[model samples]
Target: MLNILRYLKKHVGMAVLILALLCVQAYCDLTLPKYTSDIVDVGIQQSGVERVTPNQMRDTTLEALTLFLSNEDEALLRRAYAIEDGTARLTVSDSATLDRLDQALSMPMVALYQMGQQGMEPSVLIQQSEQVGVDRETFKTQLRTQIETMADQYGAAADTMTSQMAILFVRQEYQALGVDLDALQQTYLLTTGGKMLALTLLMVAAAITAGMLASRVAASVGMELRSQVFRKVVSFGSAEIDRFSTASLITRSTNDIQQIQMVVVMLLRLVLYAPIIGIGGIVRVATTRTGMGWIIGVAVGVLLALIVVLMTVAMPKFKKMQTLIDRVNLVSREILTGLNVIRAFSREEYEEKRFDKANRDLMGTQLFTNRTMSMMMPAMMLIMNGISVLIVWAGAHGVDLGTMQVGDMIAFITYTMQIVMAFLMISVVSIMLPRAGVSAKRIQEVLDTPVSIHDPAPDKNRDESKGDWRGEVCFEDVSFRYPDAQADVLEHISFTARPGETTAIIGSTGSGKSTLLNLIPRFFDVSYGRITIDGVDIRDLSLHKLHNLLGYVPQKGVLFSGTIESNLKFGGADITDAAMTQAAAIAQADDFIQAKPEGYQSPIAQGGSNVSGGQKQRLSIARAIAKQPKVYLFDDSFSALDYKTDAALRRALSQQVKDAAVIIVAQRISTILHAQQIVVLDEGKVAGIGTHEELMASCPTYQEIARSQLSDAELGGAGA
Candidate 1:
């Protein structure tokens, strides 16, 4: 959670602004119930059933007594309203503003009560001193006198202000009103008009601005964090990436990040506001001056208990839902990647059943999670209504006993709802939290993995390699091992090939030939010994410098979905048309390539699916040749070609180059019969290092492999 906070802090201003708005909204929310209490107890009920003049109404009643009330003459009020009988502004404009203003007033009054309890206010001290027969009105009279004395010094006496307010209130009267009613309307407007409008507008505008900015900031933080995670993904090696699958990691990056983002956005809008709501509920319950109002506390307690229960039930289930999403993603991926295999085997029914099982499992888990999490809302509503019933039951007795007004009951109900809803929102957030937190932890783990390889700093301590087209290659006791493998694949392998020499390695399967060849290009670092190009160790050479010196055609050829021209350009990124044609001819691929409808411009499907395996291998070889590297490692590159094409490629190659080292790994003796040297291997060890005849005569393993593939004539032809 702290990690998420740090990430979200990048958008702190937006978050803070949104939080500030929610606080304002909460202020309005808290004020409303108390205002309902005041409006019923003071405005409509206390001073009703009177046709007294507006001046008398103002002098006698508390509603008319408050300074910030608004009332209009019949005509102007009608014109300000529309024929449709609604404010011309959007609907939310009026209701939300009115709602918030009521909440604001409720807070200050609650604060007054709280201050008295804390022994920290004139009002609280006065109420305490009431024990000595100092009544509430006595303190009011004393406080009023003190204010009047201060006002005289400042030329602001209370009676003078009252007389001025009376004259001033009457002057702003609507022209259409009779004097008696007009005075009353004017007094209401004088007190509450500007303050109510300003407070409502400020709270509403702040709430809206805050919501918008917080959502934007959350999204921005999510984007930056996601990009950072992706950047880290690029640096991880195969071993590290295997800890999480492609689908799982992708889900963590996209969906998991988004979940955490929503948590951030909701927390900004709710956590601070929730506490305020709870406090307001406490204050309202505590300050209920009415008879038997203790039931409000019981109702409030039950609501809180329900929220805690729902969160506890829902959190773990939500976590399972996230894991299920990853599994669903994995299942769908496997089905798609193996679609062709499934169809060819006529197992659509089986695969469909497999997909259905995974799909249903996902649906079941999510349904459980949704049901559990959604229980919070209904559970909250039930608790709210249950408490409202209790409050009504208690308030009825208070009303009967002349201690509580009907509006007090209504206001108590409203305050209870707000408090419960705020907790309900918090509960939903609580449910979302554990799942998103788990996901955040998962993403962080991937980002924290260390990169295996890094370049040494440019200094004399590191060997520097610089060359152009020197084809000398050497392996001195070179042993290459995979991470955590039981043994080295290549052991104590000492060999060298000079420029213009064709060195062929012939061995049975699993003889470490491919692994040994992989060492030259630095695809994997040699585990035990040094492999060098010319006299420079491969590891000491920078990757860019080292890779520029050799061309490797992988055993399994791969092609991107693009034109043949584009795929070949990957070799050097700038091969000329002439060079491409020359490379194709040398690779014995020119005939079939020209046979295609678009020739060099022909589109190659992904993995060269549009072409035959032989054609794909040939194109791969052509791509390798186009680079014009000093050394070319062709690992089982000719396995797909027929004898004729194979013979032609070698013939073209021999004539085309005399200053490049060529190492070929093949299963056929005929493939390397004319090579300058051959290294035979058995298991992971080198068996014999000699020419074909020398090996045939001296090494039985080499001789036996040759006999299986060739007759006496071909075996003797190897030494011809």
Candidate 2:
């Protein structure tokens, strides 16, 4: 996965932007619970009275409440309020000052209010104290001392109990002062609700924007990866392609890349964001002072354990799943490509069974992994609900005992769930990471493979030193072996195919005929010796220049989907109509091409499946001819043509391309009987290099091959 992340370097700017947006989203989401707690505690419970200090109160009520305060607190309370027209209004607007006053006045105010509720109001107490011969100032001091002692007994919970009681007293004072409690509650609810709505909107926007950017980055990475893989594959020699196989490469290019793309999105969105939310939730819960942090710890531990178990059980299957998919793709490609052969052999049922077995293997592995991974969501939900239940059970006791409020308990639950969900999101992405990690390694494998064949570094001086180019290909003691092979496939081969002549190679099956031709184009480099063109080693030339100097037609007559004109002009856009017509004429394809309704404009199906085998071969030959290269290599290209067409085409080619070197790999004796040179091979070694007459008299391999295809009369006449 980290290897694949190199592709993201190109999109670093966008990825950073996504990370920033995810942070904003986490902030907004984490803030919402705080406001929710406020709505429950301050809005409904206290009738929108957020502070213990009343904004307005009657002068008599203020004076009576202040009696329970110490001299210092009483003086501070008087300074914060102004008595005018028998009503006192809070004069201080600074929030810090108001908060200080709320702390100082809460216990005294709550103690007096509770006494009043039990029929001992401050005014009643003063009257009864005078009746019992107690002075007002002494009575006030005694009352203040008793309230301080009670607060001392409450310890750390004093603030919470005092704040709750003070809010009740503030509500009663607001009612006594004719304040519209309904309007106040409505305003507070609307303000807090409005902030929550704004945060929600902000969260939604950030999430949407972050999601879009993440998708773009993932898509761009996927595109760049696909392009790199394709260009790398295109540069690969036969050795690398054989090592990876076409089916596996296809899966890597498509399925494997898709896995990386998906994981990148999750990495941007969830993986980066989960830690922020989880840590932020932990911080928020700490401030709530609910002392329920243990619940979150337990939930996280369980989640970790569950994730480990599931990943362990499913990881091997995830790795196996990719291989199974490759197998399925391999089987499917083979069946489709060989459908005709399979039917010809009446093996459709057998092929179906083969396909079914691959499909079921893939399905069975997927089912096992899917079933194992499927346990995660239920188990996660179970953990989450269990945590919620535990919090509610413990928090209910705290609420009953007055150590925690209903709103505080609710907020604690929200934060706990947030923390759990954070882990859940990470676990989900982790589950996908194993498969994606496999995919990343697969893709990186293709990208990292070294091409067995490479172009030489440029040298303008060396390039200019080579005089005029006249095609002269020579193989000097060339011994070739495929990669990892124990023995050479072609050994000690020496030959020259010079300009203005035809050199033909003939061999029994598996005689390295095609391999010899492939070396000229540097599809595979020679193992022991060198091949040269114009006295310069072919490897010294860049691939583009080397390929441009030779026209190659493969044995299979492969054609891309296009019209006759397109196929004929495939050599380059510079190929003119006249050149295309001339090449087609020389290949004996113009006659049938003119018979078609659209002639050169006719559409060709993929792989030229719409054309006959003979026509496809001729069109391929025509394409090569249109290039007007210095050398021509025909690898059994004439096998599809009948005797008449082959003879005419050869005759025309001999005349038209007389100045160019022509090398033909032929199976038919009639095809190379009149060649200027014939190289016959028995196995990997050259058996003979001579004219047909010279070979028939000297080489038994040539004589056997000639006599097998020709009667005595034909052989005599040809030799003569």
Candidate 3:
């Protein structure tokens, strides 16, 4: 996973933008619950009277309420209100002054409002004080002292009750002032609802923009990772390719990279946002003071435990899923490529079973992991609903006891769900992370594998311009061993093929004939000794310069999807129509190419599957001939052609390629009977190096190979 994150360095700017957008989205989403509580508390319950300090009141009412306040609070309230005719209008609008006045008057307002509910008006109280032989100011002082003593006895509960009753008093004052109560309620609801709508839309916009930017970053990372893997694989030697199979490499490039892309989007969208919502919800819930914070703690703890158990059970299966997918792909490719061979052997049922086994293994692992992860949603819903029920049950007591308002209870429920949902989002991503981590490691493996074959540095490479540039390839005591092999496949091999000579290597099966020819191109570097071109080691020449001087044709012909003309001109972009036609004629492919309806424009399917074996070989030969390189290496390139076509091709090749060395690796003795030199191999060591006539006279391995394919009369004729 850390290796995969390195790709994100190139996209840091976009990542930061995504994070900022997520923060905005989180802020908007979190604030909506506060307005929801306000719409219920202020809009519906208080008759839209939000302030405990009444906005307007009659002068008699203001003076009556001030009777319960200290001298300083009375002076502050007198200054905060302005008298006009018989009414006092609140002149202070700032929250600080209103809150201070509200604090000063809340208990007094609640005490007076309770007395009025019992049918005792302030006039009645003044008459009672006169009956008791006390002045009105002294009676007011005694009433204020009684209210303060009762509030101190009730502690925090009195504060909550005081605020509720004070709002009721403010509502009655508004009615007395002839304000429209219904209009004020409607205005508060509409205003709060509008703010909620705006916040919701803003949250939606932030979410969409963040999602789009995250997807773009993920897609860019996927593209770059695929390119890097492809270039790395292209530079791999034969040994490196063999180390990681083709099917595994394909899975890594496509399926594994796709996994990383999906996780990247999730990481950007949820990983940063979940914590913001969760922690912010916790803070807001604490402020609600409903004493139900333990419910949220319990829900989050259970959610975490559930997530840990599910991931623990599914992680190993996630690891195995990618390998099983590789197996399925490998089996499918093998059956498709060898379909004809399977049918010829009457092994269709066996092949079907082979494919089914691979497919079932993959399917079974996927099903188990899916079933395990499937339990998460229902379990989360259970936890959420269960906690919700618990909150409502406990919150009902607080509401009945007059400590918590209905709107506060509703807000608490919302915040509890928000906290639970945040954990759920994080848990979902946690489950995905293990699988994506497995995929990241798989992709990283291909990128991190060291290439066994490397080109020389520019200063160390051979300069072809400084030399005569004749293609003289020499293997000087060359020995090669496959990676981790017990012994060398080619031992003490020494040979030289001049620019104007035909040097053919003929050996029985398992004698490293193709392996030896591959050495000239450095497909696998020599382990013990060096092969040189113009006295410069092949390794000392950059791959580009070395391949430019040599044309190679493998035993199995390979062609890409294009027209016949395209395949023939594949050797170099500078190859012309004349050169393509001449080269095709020399390789005896012109007859077939011209006979086709499209001729040079004839389309070839992928891997040349549309063409026959012999036609593919001829086209392969023509492609090399069109290059006109100084040396040509053919590794059993003529096995598919008939005797007549092969003989004609060799004759034309010798005439046209007199100044370039040609090396052929062949299984048939007749293919190289007339060569300028033939190298014979018994095991790994060369047994003879001479003309065919000279080899039949002196070398047993050459005599055995020649007698196996030729009649006594033909052999004697060749010797003569």
Assess each prediction's global lDDT (C-alpha) against the native: 0.69, 0.90, 0.90
Score every model by TM-score: 0.72, 0.96, 0.96
Write one digit per residue (lDDT tens) for candidate 3, span 112-166. 7888899766556545656756777787789888898978876757867889898
What stretches of model 2 exceed 4 Å from their correct place? 70-72, 119-141, 152-157, 460-464, 717-720
How many collisions per candidate? Answer: 11, 0, 0
Which scores greater on lDDT, model 1 or model 2? 2
Please, what are the lDDT tens digits per residue for candidate 1 over residues 1-720?
Answer: 776777776776766667667778777766656655544543454222111112111111122112122223222222322333211211223555434433322222232323434655433343454567766555544544544454455342332233223333332221212344444444444333444566678778867777777778778878887898898876555555666789888888988898878887787776656887777766775665554445655665776677677767766777777788888888888888788998999988998898798788879878887877667667777787877788888778766644556876787777767767766767777777787788788778777777654444676223444535487999898777787888877788899988899999878899888878877776566788898788777777766666777777878777889998888777776788888899899988888889888998999887788888888898888888888888888898999989999999989988765689999999888899888889998887889998877887788788889889999777765533
Q: Which residue pairs in candidate 2 have backbone atoms (N, alpha carbon, C) closer than 3 angstroms, thus clashing?
A: none
Write down the RMSD of candidate 3 (Cα, Å). 2.1
* Model 1 worst lDDT window (10 residues): 49-58
Shift in Å, residue 125, candidate 3? 6.6
Per the 3 Å backbone cut-off, how many clashing residue pairs does candidate 1 have? 11
RMSD to truth, every model: 12.2, 2.3, 2.1
